[model samples]
Target: MPTVPSANPAEHLARTVDIVALLERGRAMSTPVLRAAVDRLAPPMNTVSSYHFGWIDAQGRPAEGDGGKAVRPALALLSAEAAGAAPEVGVPGAVAVELVHNFSLLHDDLMDGDEQRRHRDTVWKVHGPAQAILVGDALFALANELLLELGTVEAGRATRRLTTATRKLIDGQAQDISYEHRERVTVEECLEMEGNKTGALLACAASIGAVLGGADDRTADALERYGYHLGLAFQAVDDILGIWGDPESTGKQTWSDLRQRKKSLPVVAALAAGGPASHRLGELLAADVKSNDFESFSEEEFAARAALIEAAGGRDWTSEEARRQHAVAVETLDAVDMPEQVRAQLTALADFVVVRNR
Candidate 1:
């Protein structure tokens, strides 16, 4: 577990606490509930989901593998604590958000034709696209079932929030896929798409626990705002990693976003910068769009495009934007009334997102 980079002197105490331990607490609490939900799926769906969750190998044998960062679940639990409820009170919300997150991952991997995730074969590559779609749908439905079965008003409220976020997530994915074919996508448009795709779900995760704990709309909304900005910061950093992160750290090929021609923050910002490097980068990208045979691009070609994108200031602009969003996220917390310890943890989590290497 790597140390979380501290954003300020005030965060020193929280920064000293291991973020991995915080994430593990979320994973440990949610795994049993998550597994139970998945177990309810019939036949191959259950088996396939187990494999996707890294609980089992493709052969159906048990094997510990990368599940995920469990960031959402951690936030969920902390949100409950923020609302003066026990962490266990947030388990259902934690599991539900995790379900929704994985559901998107399944569909996104298939839609993007990504063959690997977390250093393992993706569900689509291992089982087939049809199975991937079916399992993703099942997980989504199970998420609703888990919450609804609770039969509490809070549960109902949380479900409504989760469904709305899921819809926005879908919308974001649609926009993302469409952006790939278009020659020009404005930075504003990209931010809107990302807000829908990544921000919505994180907003839900950040607030759903509090919703379940019976927090008022005002508190929930403020927390959601915090999460929404944090998501943007998270995505900005992710965009950086997608283009510049090491293959070993990112678990993807070099110039991964470039190969996919994703109109991510860096690309869009660079295109918007309007200079010699920007013009050349746009021309090269346009040529790729015209040819549209991204698979044929060599390592040298991808390297050249990446260099142009940086020279155009895409990388630097996005780095600054990440810190800006992170600051805004932390500021939002000031408006909420919560325990100082929980607030520290949330601030630390925000710091983790901006500084995470992978």
Candidate 2:
């Protein structure tokens, strides 16, 4: 058995270095492909798409922004490397995954009524809802088009994988919307919803590179499992950040999730805890539901609810769960006999998922 590096204090610095380098490479490779693909769109659509990606401003001029972490694309490239293929072999898959991701983001922002993303106005807020929806549709179509341009066999498989993931993502979003209207939600249901909403795409991304690289089914399956668990961890951490993260770092209002009355993991966990704090939170949430006003929470009220969640052990439980999922993701890599370097990088990425501030 290849010895996996322990996620110990001594390994922290090295792991961070590996994660940063892998992410940088992913960004470098995926960005150009994404730009070229978006450039193929017609005038206003192209401008809207570019603005959504932080590539250009509303005036169709260049802008300065980090875009995003490019985590899914990085996973695709890394999976290809783990399958013993050159990173370039996965560029098409990486680009396809990223387009699908952004497509979902554009639609999600509209559905969720989000005003800001990455500390800037969302596409819908800036470009109008109709145009944003059209652009999202265009991006989704483009993802399929790009994947089909690959050789026949690979294109067919990747298209099937991506389509299935997209379906699950949509189903998850529907469920999430429904959950908000209900008075109660179980943790199990929330996990399942998150798996479909977030995990499906990440799983597809992790395996697409392997599929393109001609890796065996076993290797592809293992990487898919790795991504699924990583997705869960990522969502769990995101829930924590939703209520507690710095507005500047997270690129959203502080306690934004609570203000929206989102039934995220931490909130669900606290509701299930059944303590005094939980009871108080339930009352607050109930009042909000009765008022039908999600945007009414004052900063002080949001802070109080956050404190209640922490007092009820929601924060700790969610944090520990994120770490647990991260561990599972790392362990799944053991099933694939990749090069030590590739495994190390994958492990680092897993660590980064749980630890990222945004």
Candidate 3:
């Protein structure tokens, strides 16, 4: 992983402290509010949401498990600070975004038929698809309720932003599902889908806090741009991980995306880069398409496809694109004037986004 940038010893220590501290800080600040929001659900939904959040086990016993990285909440809080407001001012934004994020996860696991996440049974797997759909709907409602109840102009603005992003996210998911059945998905098409699916919500997260903190549109827009590019970088890295990441860390089986025949960035780029290896990779993929025999694919078959992707420079291209997007994300920050400390923290978070393993 890349080291956090440091200008001087004292600044470095401050940046490091801020960087490490914000994740825990965000979790601490957002969890109670999020739990309270989840508690609004009736009966089994409450139980299911609680279990999904890792606050309890499947048997209703209190047990701590991995929740998530809390990246959105941290960004919300940091964005508040960037707007020259107290971090506490961003708590509602933090909780709302976190709620929206988990809502997506619940639905995504069910839609994608993913049985595992964070090394545990997915809500859909453990609780069933009915509960997953119900609880996801409940969470989405709760996210809007939390924001709209604030009853301020800024709150109204933030709600509109969140809803807009949610619509785009849904659109992206639709595009993703549609792309799966098609034989050819262009690199441009893939980026657009990812930009909507991943980038839209991240842009909202990056600016919603500032909106709630009463920031002007210019500053909020700049931060939104920062987050949009950061989201692209994040998804690119994620595509790479989907193919080559360690299953133990990723909480998925080996060759996970390949098993699903996901046309992620690497796969699209590899097919776009024509060569002997690329042609062979295309043949293999075309054969799989015709057979529709992903389940019967042997370990060696998946491994050979992975190797072909690498030899065709798919992996390297995606990696370079990640760095390029990261640069753009960081550069967008220049348009906003905020505390120096907050700037460093946002940059650190952007670094974390591009370099993160999961």
Q: In angstroms, what RMSD does candidate 2 have relative to the true structure?
A: 3.1
The runs of at least 3 residues in candidate 2 whose Cα sits more than 4 Å from the true structure, single-residue gaps closed, are 1-17
Best by TM-score: 1
Tens digits of per-residue lDDT, candidate 3, 143-192, equal 99999999999999999999998998899988988877777789999999
Note the Cα lDDT for every prediction shown. Answer: 0.91, 0.86, 0.88
Candidate 1 error regions (>4 Å): 1-10
Q: Estimate the TM-score for candidate 3.
A: 0.95
lDDT of 3: 0.88
Q: Indicate which candidate wins on lDDT.
A: 1
For residues 288-313, write the lDDT of model 2, one tens digit per residue.
77788755557898899899998988
TM per candidate: 0.97, 0.95, 0.95
Whole-structure CA lDDT of model 2:
0.86
Model 1 lDDT tens row, 138-227: 999999999999999999999999999999999999999999999899999999999999999999999999999999999999999999
Can you give the lDDT of residue 215 in candidate 3?
99
User: Residue 168 of model 2: what lDDT?
Assistant: 93
TM-score order of candidates, best first?
1, 3, 2
How much does candidate 1 score in TM-score?
A: 0.97
